[model samples]
Target: MQKKGHRDSYTTNNQKGTVAITDDTVKLPKIGHIKAKFPAKINGLIKSATVSKDPTGKYFVSLLVETIVEPLPKTHSNIGIDLGLTDFIVLSDGSKVANPKFLSKLQHKLAREQKILAKRRAVAKADQRKLSDSRNYQKQKVKVAKVYEKITNIRKDFLHKLSFNLIKNHDVIAIEDLNVKGMVKNKKLAKAISDSSWSTFTTMLNYKAEWYGKKLIKVDRWYPSSKTCSGCGHLLTKAELPLQVRSWDCPSCQQKHDRDINASINILNEGLKLATIKTVGTTGLA
Candidate 1:
């Protein structure tokens, strides 16, 4: 079977290497004669199959069969993921996925260009700031825009691959639906908040789970997915845990906690209910 592009992957297997062409005559294992429509043709050996759409406005299919499962093995190990400003996701499995510090990394160039833009704006020109209409300002704007875009893309790619890896190795996944929009209201953290892309990471995880036949369990928007203890099931009073305290010891269990790991544990537990109910869990949403 020939491989297809990442965005439009397809594979065909069987002695015929193709299914007979016809409307409402698709071949699948066990259920040999099934139904389909345009762009859905018989391809490859019969197997459990499904078709679906994507956010980008496209259709695709996935087939499960006995031939091969590729290197993507299901490890059945689970991890709780904590969302934060100091870090992106802290896994309950004790693996820390560091937040790339995107804004911090790109801050120098951003500040420089922004300063230039500010200087241009301060000129107070009636015709518009000289810098606003100037060729150099426009050039800087493009440069800055591209940098912003590049950083955003880098974050997205990294998050998607990470989520995919998690789905491949684990039986279940847990995460928080952060109050991102509300948190961004803080003037000081707004830029860093925008760069974090916590929501985007969750989006990738949501769909990847479904595609891979894994579980994406979401705790709740209001639940403190982070401030609870996974080991002792003890919750710190809201004032007990402060933003800067990245590490602590659970009072009840006496287990030392890395903020992310603890949050992850809470998420894992909360996600269990979701794993059992399709209507409850939204671990991954494309």
Candidate 2:
């Protein structure tokens, strides 16, 4: 009751927090002057900073540094990456990122804890009737929390590695702008789509591109990236693309399509066109 009801006390009694600006040492809330992993070296002046705890209970300090990175001579060879269920990511550069389905493998353990948590919830409610101590209930909650934490850590590690590799190697990366909400609504392939981790991949790619002096291109969600024939640039008029159809030849172009690679090429071209427009002082391009 106190934990749930005493919101005011929680904030008021929190330890003092301060952001460490560039060249200025500021004391952290609980931990004092811990050195930053890497000083943000930027072209311009330093700005405000924010520190927060993530859902997995990890504390992170975010430095908002004022900076300008002059883009390198444009590579002119932009590549698009298609996130996948089986292969994880298929890049136009012919690079493949293997899908390590962390959640699927951990489902049994997660389900076990969830089942236990459900049972504990019932017990907690019964105890509420008896006005009993919540020590065991709290323990069960922690067990469930630990499983979630493990899942999050696995995801973070995978994303960081994937993002770093892409940013390091590619000059301009293009991806399909995914409407996760809309994709989730399709119950048929929802699990596979979620497991593909397109949302996470896009988010990581976006931030990493900024940090690594790479350009990110986000094509429209509705754009027929997948259905378009990469070689001939012909649109596919198929009513439905089955999940099982890994490769197909375009009816119009007769070009064989490796589904993911075809999508990646379309994304790449779209990104290249957008970059050209931006360079030519166009704010909006149709």
Candidate 3:
């Protein structure tokens, strides 16, 4: 089967003449040495390699290497992060990370590219041209694809940096178990939720936490982190806490709280509780 404008990829085993990696280039099974960029030194035995061409006409090689997972030095710091659309992440330590909003920033450019692509497709259709034979349409399609690819790369870079920072500095990283799929069903916040890419960020945190021997704790989604007071442990009713209220004062303790930061603190406390229990018995969210 073939797609009109889709990526093509293939994987090769590490058998003889299958795959070989050098300082700057990689030798594929039959495709001799190709110029490549290796961002980091490959530190392990190469197991396999997969090569693929993206819709934007860029090629990439992903090497599967087997290496010893070395843990990072302990920093003895624990942090809780609250992910949100307003700000990307709010830490329990009262630090806020602004959302990059990469897709939103490039929306106008993407719209222009999409319009051009649509016009080219229309012209090709009017001429009854096959998509594969329509040079203009294909070219415009690649332009549109490149715009999307750029946004994806920017988002991924941001996530990697943020995850690395947290994993490297913190011994325990606590975050809420977000119901991203359900959150996106809200039409008003759907775009923002999708743009934040909370799931991808959490996945990065998970794997990196493991690699660095850090604890990644996911508190239960149903926990009343936002409604509970971090200082007084007072639980506010759902009716009392609304989305519009970004800051609130605890009735019991009279302590003012930034909504996200308070929730992050609560998450951190709960995660620590879980961690304490895990040391003695089975590990669980509760």
Candidate 4:
């Protein structure tokens, strides 16, 4: 049987002696009160708290905060986003946000650290030293962990900022529902696809849209956004609009289209249609 990595965590409920919270500190059973920074104010009655440690050896406490948030004022502007490997996101407005491949950029550094860690592990193994008892091995392991942690933090920060901006400014946002798992099956594109982090971005858009009272529409993945001509609505066969052809003139309308931008426009239109249909159905019910 394969061994599973253990998860480090403990939970405490809101009792007089168990867990307590103040403006800038958290109190645990035997640890007493520890000073902590609050990114946002915690509202509502004291709830249960779960303290967990991540692979990076950093500790985090998750508080179940029951709070109400007022929705921001509605914005009339809407947008469509096309996720691609070349650009992180191409918006319907013709803006291309370059992909900051954090992991790719730091691959060399990570490889160097892993090399050192491997040497340490090998020495420990050759000497018949237990890995748990090898101080050097453990130290090198943490070094490797820190690199991974940095990459995760950078990607998360970028995604959160981008998602927040979209939700704050747009009334409705449209994106293709990507089959990320299936797409990653291609050996050539798997690394690029994973680095793109499309799934995480869309997930953030989904929840943030709900929290901010904005609309997030997911067009079908199989919808031929790329092959359809935005000008004349003429659909091109897969052969005519192959992946290699990045730009082309529409035969039906004779208008030139930048492949990704044109696809974003199509996505925007489809999203608007879906939003309209939903609104009509809701009004009819009311």
Candidate 5:
């Protein structure tokens, strides 16, 4: 059960039997022949349909369809990705994708809108009127919701494109299994970490890799990818590689390392080892 005044969406299962779709309309069980815009041609068996109303008062229907996905042509390329707040991702091949920080970019605008919302709410309260009945308050509420919706859509778009390109280009992709939940416990970094949306990116990578017949190897969270020397297999002490240290020299090999790049390389090597083990175990090979 959802909390009162909080439920904004519901789903209908077995939509194949109850729902019908035409080029320009959708027929739900109760709602008959609602005109809808088709973003693309729907060419699959409909399993379920979700109807949702956003805080901004926009209604959307999402159809879950079962369809065969054709895998992309093989690139035979592999890459390791190190996710970070500074750069969204650092590739083992020395490439970096900048963190877009969608929330931070629009934070000031959101705050301005939210300030109006708060004032409107106060006005309603001062007038001894219920918030639900206040027109101005509702309007400002929608404005705040629109800002949040914009941020979410932008972030999802970036993640989808990045994940799709990585899946399309790499035969095997390796990424660290970060302890995001634990990492966010740090109050100072929580907001930035949430804005980074690492979990969403990794989730995208996981599903897309499977859909495209590719491999996604997750290096264990415990692995000290950042502290290990990618070139010489030497591990640095925790004191030697503090959180603020961005670059370092390997003591044993005297090799220089850009922290994120070295971590990505190490993650790739470890992922390859894990893949080899899995392959050997599956094939019963020496």
Candidate 6:
């Protein structure tokens, strides 16, 4: 059971043999063939479908299918990723991906629409009318929802493409086991951190690596990847490596380091050690 005015969608389980999908339409139980546009061809056997409606008044159907996925060709390459706010990701190979900041790009427009919706809600309450019965409020609500949906779709698209590229080109990928939940507790950084969507990006990397038969490793959170110098393995004190310092010189080796790239390299080294241990344990070989 769903709470009143809470759920906007429902799911149908064990829909195998009860549902049929074509290139452009889906046949569901109780509902006949409905015209739908799919992003790509559905190739596998459909097991279940969850039909959902967005606040924008658009209906969507998600099909769970069983299919065989072939692994990508081996590249014999490995890399580490450092996730950040200014840059989306910095790789151990010295390449960096810029943060798209999808939410920030549309913040003003979204704010304007949301303000209008709030005013409409106030008007509806003043008239002693249910929100569902208020046409203006409903319309404005859809507008606000559309803005949010746009941001989500754009962000997901970017993450998927990036994750796919990394999986396809590399045999092993290492990333930090970030405590995003704890990090977001900082009031000043909460909005920026949420907008960065670090968790979503990592989740994409995890599943994509599995699908491509690639290895994804998470370095321990307490490892202090950032405070260590990649070149000479020199560790920095907390006072020496402040948050504002993006680059620094190692005292032990006098090696110049870009903070994110140095951290990524450390993650790569640590991940390789972990991977070797895992392999030896599984194979029972020294």
- Please report, as a residue range, the 10-residue window in candidate 5 with the lowest summed lDDT: 1-10
Error of 2 at 236 (Å): 2.8
Q: Rate the local accuracy (lDDT) of all candidates.
A: 0.69, 0.71, 0.91, 0.90, 0.92, 0.91
Candidates arranged by lDDT, highest first: 5, 3, 6, 4, 2, 1
Clashing pairs in 3: none
Q: Per-residue error at 261 for model 4, in Å?
A: 0.8
Superior by TM-score: candidate 2 or candidate 3: 3
Per lDDT, the best of the predicted structures is: 5
Per-model TM values vs. the true structure: 0.63, 0.74, 0.96, 0.94, 0.94, 0.96
How many clashes show up in model 1? 6
Q: Summarize candidate 3's per-residue lDDT along 10-68 as a digit string, tens digits.
A: 78888864788788889888788999999898888889998888998889999999899
Determine which window of 10 residues in candidate 6 has minimal summed lDDT.
1-10
C-alpha RMSD by candidate, in order? 12.2, 5.4, 2.3, 2.3, 1.9, 1.6
Clashing pairs in 2: none
Query: lDDT tens string, model 2, 141-230?
Result: 667777877877888788888887777777888887878878888998697778667788788888878876788988887888888888
Query: Model 6 Cα displacement at 192 (Å)?
Result: 1.1
| Residue range 1-286, candidate 6, lDDT tens digits | 2554554666675554678877778888898689999998777778888887767788899988889999999999999999999998999999999989899999999999989999999999999999999999988888998999999999989988999999999999999999999999999889889999999989999998899899999999999999998888888888989999999999999999999999999999999999998998989964
> How many steric overlaps does candidate 3 have?
0
Residue pairs in clash, model 5: none
CA shift of 30, model 2, Å: 8.9
What tens-digit string does per-residue lDDT give for candidate 4 at 126-200?
Answer: 999999899998888889889988999899999999999999999999999999999999999999999989999
lDDT score of residue 163 within candidate 5 = 97
Per-residue lDDT tens digits of candidate 1, residues 86-205?
Answer: 767778777777779876887898788778756555554544655546766566556666666667767777887888888888978888777889989999998787788877878888
What value of lDDT does candidate 6 attain over all alpha carbons? 0.91
